[model samples]
Target: MNTIDEQLWDYIDGNLDAAQASIIKEKIDTDAEVKNQYEELLRFNLTFDKIELEEPSMSFTRNVMESVAIVPAPVAMKTQVDKKIIYSIGGFFIISLLALFGYVLYNSNLTMPGFDQKINFNFNLDKYITPTTVYSFLFADLVIGLIFLDRFLRDKIVQSKKI
Candidate 1:
């Protein structure tokens, strides 16, 4: 027979084995202090369990559905021109440009303010495209490409192994 206060409390709360429960019941009936303690705990448990849960209004779900119904579904836009139509428009533009060029050649002002003075605009290509500049640019491109390739290969290997 268990006389420990915790064991007695457990048995009273319906958490004890059948044999243990009998022992606690015998103790509670015989001991006044144990009986009073058990009653107090039971009362607290019942009081908390009886507290009511709050409910929302009956129209809450209906109001939410009404709001959702008011909103319009998103619509997708349709294309007006296909590939053939785009090609036809491009052909028309080219033909118009050719006609304009022919008209300009046939009639244009041959005299200008600075017609006698020739403007010689020469850009030194050597300054920009040196051997060192080309090599450094190529090296930087190679490094960036290598980094992406390494990541792609690693991911492919992992996926292949998983499969």
Candidate 2:
């Protein structure tokens, strides 16, 4: 709205100090436009004062709370996982690892020397243990460690939230 309406509103609400109120009062008395606006605002204020606000029924809050209570509480996404599914996945991985280890051992060739014969241990591990192999193994270990740490932290957070 214009400054005139704002000043008139302030004057009607008695928000303006004596000096500002007197200036607005003088304008309302002398200017026909100002006088008309002031009378309209005064009628609106009186109408607003006469209005009776309707209140809600006494059981409104109780009814709303009862409906809310009938609805189920939300469950965490992680908590929705079934224990049987996790156990099955873990069992599958364990069995696969055991089978792989057995296959490796069964295919390998190694001879055990008799007690009467001298045992010769002349195997060089340098060929199998290259720098790249070592770095890859370390990187794999770091990635696995981070995965485990992440799982541990997530579980901790879920547990804390439950409390």
Candidate 3:
């Protein structure tokens, strides 16, 4: 009556005492909903009882483990480039940067006029440009060009070596 509870299932499963089971049986007989729920639970229990556990053949597990062990583990390609070679290349760039910064600080000739020098403002870009600056620009461009060419040639040589 007061809505079917777990005690009803316990009764259906024969987990309850005779007295409790009798009480549930009386309620199930009187209540349509309780009767339907009990019957459904009974069918489910019967179906579950009919089901059997299946065991795989003994070799099934052994075969699976063997297959997994047979799978090759990935490996990293050992590089020909030495650690010292990489460090030297990085050190060279660092030294070059430091030298450039040192040169700029040494020759900057920055005078803080502070509005006293009466700086003449000129829009003429040609007067500000110098041969040394142009050559420096060309030198930097050439260095970059050489680095790219080296990379391209190195890649081609490596690829050819592979073949």
Candidate 4:
């Protein structure tokens, strides 16, 4: 066991057993360092206890609730992936990527800028495959496909209602 300072302090605070308390009492009487450390900790704890906490404004909770009501609640993110949704999105992404890749391959082989033998890097294929062009195609296709799907679903719902 280490120094009895913690047990001594706990004993002072009435938080120790009678046996533990008696052991600390004997140490405190003989150990000058333990006695001084225990007194310092107790003084620090007493200082914090003496400081008062101010209560919040009377309408604080109400005002906070009112402000929160004015601000829209954050949309909860979907925790589980729907396989159909994943497949749809993945399919669209792959299709768009392949289309862009085909376009780049065609353009690069035909009339791409900075592709002249005098100006082009001899090794980097990224010279032909631009990220900006690929991303633009991907985003455009994704958005367009989503819009078309939404419209098709809406039309089906309307038709079913009529039927």
* All models, RMSD in angstroms: 19.6, 14.5, 19.0, 19.6
Ranking by lDDT: 2, 3, 1, 4
lDDT of each model, Cα atoms only?
A: 0.85, 0.94, 0.87, 0.85
Candidate 2 accuracy as TM-score: 0.43
Misplaced by over 4 Å in model 4 are 1-5, 78-163
lDDT of 2 by residue, 1-163 (tens): 9999999888988999999999999999899999999999999889998999999999999999999999999976674689899999999999999999999999997666674777789878998899999999999999999999999999999999989
- Looking at model 4, the pairs that clash are none
Q: What lDDT does model 2 reach?
A: 0.94
Location of the lowest summed lDDT over 10 successive residues in candidate 4: 1-10
Worst lDDT run of 10 residues, candidate 1, spans 1-10
**Candidate 1 accuracy as lDDT:** 0.85
TM-score of candidate 1 relative to the true fold:
0.32
TM-score of each predicted structure versus truth: 0.32, 0.43, 0.34, 0.42
Q: Model 2, poorest ten-residue lDDT window? A: 109-118
Query: Which run of 10 residues does model 3 get worst, by summed lDDT?
Result: 1-10
The parts of candidate 2 lying over 4 Å away from their true place are: 70-163
Q: Residue-wise lDDT of candidate 3 within 13-50, one digit each (tens)?
A: 68988888889989999999888888888898889999
In the range 93-155, model 4's lDDT, one tens digit per residue, is 999999999998888756568755665547767876799889999999999999999999999
